[model samples]
Target: MKKPLQKSKIPSNKVFVIKELREAYLDKYWHSHEEYQLNVILKGRGTRYIGDHMKPFKEGDLVLTGPNLPHVWRCDNAYFDPESRLETHDIVIYFPESFLGKDSLQKDEFEEIRKLLARADRGLEIKGHTNKVVIKMMKELVHRQGGASIIGLLEILNVLAHSTELEPITQIDYKNNYTAHEKDKISEILEYVLHNFKNKITLKEVAELANMSESAFSRYFKARVNKSFSDFLGDVRISNARKLLQDEDLNISQVCYESGFPTISNFNKQFKDRIGKTPMAYKKDVIDSL
Candidate 1:
């Protein structure tokens, strides 16, 4: 059940590399690598999975991932529509922890950058105006080469180091051991839950999928995923409900039932608890932003 280990094909001569991805969607399976990653989504909205965290990601979403941290951005169903002509696009920058040399991060001049990189061990999301600045720098670097490209990366890291508009994306104590079998097992569970979350699910049912008794499955899942199965299912349902809420076609009750909550009252309670806003209010805010 282990997920694949994606060996990043960085050029041997380059200290860091940047690439632009334009496709129907990103790779499907969960994977990890040995390089730090800075990802900026230019055109896409979907579920983003990092470590044991899963949430929605849209355009302007900027995230920095520490080396060997597993991550993926799965595009929404609309993007795969034959008639929609939608495409997924993003800018990705990859560099090793010591890209600047073995002793560079230990130098006084790199103190801030070193700290920033260290915090990325839990993953970091660049936000607010800082996201804007870093995106611009990334764009510039995409078109530059040689010494200029390296300098651009330095500038981008410096800006990130000084920016306070950053949020940690993973748990404080999360560690990546890269257990392939367990990773694949969790990946399978995630895929099944995401696709079937709208239907009735029970602990016994999923336990069978993992080939364990309900009690054993519960402990195994909680230990590896850092959350109970019920909580994880609720999160998946709520995340999808948020997306459906933004659509003009669905009303509150429709979204509530469609998102797998058996009753509107239950959906309202869960929505408020998870999103910090009532469904209608959340919809209004998204519309206002538009």
Candidate 2:
């Protein structure tokens, strides 16, 4: 899809920019930029969108996005409440391909970094120990200046290059091919669904939102997203259900209703189908992992 290519705003005198951001809510716009980005969410929980991939992101989530990969980190609805005190904190670094110098990365010694950057084209979520190390370096980076900051970035990249804990956020074959008009239509549809998925959503409602007939919208969405509308809606509901299930205070029945499923039987069956586990089992896993 056609995304806004924002300039990284790396100063004319600087090799890169390392900054700390605190926002009422993370930017929810769907867009892309020409510079590579490394981000660590210091405080937030939300749905992360990387190209075609959709997943929940939480505090300490570390991700690297290569140039031109459309993405967004949308905060949960609670953060948007008018009287809410919720805000997000992040450490973000943005740089261009030339940060490694014109010919430096071409050398065999820099092969790993080059490959890492290439892999980042699909967006990477740094996990486990690698995330910890990179995040540590990133925190220290904001305090460094001049030569020190540049060196700090290189060291972080080096650690990332050799790390085996990177997870690809999107599929390898995924590509953006929609025009601005179509992208706008799909974005609006998703925005509506995302905001209102807690309640029942019908095909006619979303189809009308996209200004298309029910059948037309179904075909268009399936062709571009590679999933049927009902499947996508189920995925959205399941995602929210997964989040709700993590809270011990919420029972399965509550999770089912809160996530928009009409019945516990349907919720359990669909949850198992998509998550490969029952809600109770998944909740147990979350507790164990903690």
Index of the highest-lDDT prediction:
1
| Model 1 per-residue lDDT at 247 | 90
Candidate 2 lands at a TM-score of 0.92
What digit string (tens of lDDT, one per residue) describes model 1 on residues 12-126? Answer: 8889989999988766567777899999999988788898788888899899999878877877767767788888889999999889888889999999999999999989999
**Every candidate's lDDT:** 0.86, 0.86
| Candidate 2: clashing residue pairs, number | 0
Runs of candidate 2 with Cα error greater than 4 angstroms are: 1-13
Per-residue lDDT value at 109 in model 2: 88
Q: Which regions of candidate 1 fall more than 4 Å away from where they truly are?
A: 1-3, 80-84
TM agreement with the true structure for every prediction: 0.92, 0.92
